[model samples]
Target: MANPKRKWSKARTARARSNWKLSVPGLVECPQCHTKKMPHKVCKTCGYYNGKVVVQSEEQD
Candidate 1:
């Protein structure tokens, strides 16, 4: 088996893992319902996508 020759430095390890933080998903408003939703996906509240109805929503008014 292969092994590292030297110990890794703290700065090097931190720099490599600096971008490991989680980022919030980008959300957009549903045009039909005007509610927050992920882009290109069906809105859970309105069951809509691209200004059209894709799924039959359960909580309809």
Candidate 2:
């Protein structure tokens, strides 16, 4: 197997790893309440998904 000619510097390694980052979760508007939420998941605020109420929300209790 071919080996690297030279060792990578710490700065170069860090620069490459700097791109490894936490991205913001993709958020879409809830159709029923107009609040931001993750797509295809139950709306945390109103507990609605796919045009229907899946879980009863606290506000309605």
Candidate 3:
């Protein structure tokens, strides 16, 4: 096994870590249900995707 030869500098490490952020995920409204959901994914509330129902029984849960 090998180890790092030099300790990482604070500035460099901070700059690299600066890009680590919690950006809000992209969301699009379902045309049928008018609910916010992730783009191109089945809506958890209504289970619709691409203008069609993908799940048969979802509201029971």
For residues 1-61, write the lDDT of model 2, one tens digit per residue: 9998769988998898987765777999999999999998999999999998999966796
Please, what are the lDDT tens digits per residue for candidate 1 over residues 3-33? 8876888888888798776688899988888
lDDT of 2 at 31: 95
Q: Which model scores highest in lDDT? A: 2
Stretches of candidate 3 off by over 4 Å are: 1-9, 58-61
Instruction: Give the higher-TM-score candidate: 1 or 2.
Output: 2
TM-score, per-candidate, Cα-based: 0.65, 0.70, 0.64
lDDT of 3: 0.82
Question: What TM-score should be assigned to candidate 2?
Answer: 0.70
lDDT by residue for model 3 over 5-37, one digit each (tens)?
A: 669888888888987775888999988789898
Q: Which runs in model 2 stand beyond 4 Å of their true positions?
A: 1-8
RMSD of each: 4.2, 3.0, 5.5
Evaluation by TM-score, superior candidate among 1 and 3: 1
Per-residue lDDT value at 9 in model 3:
82
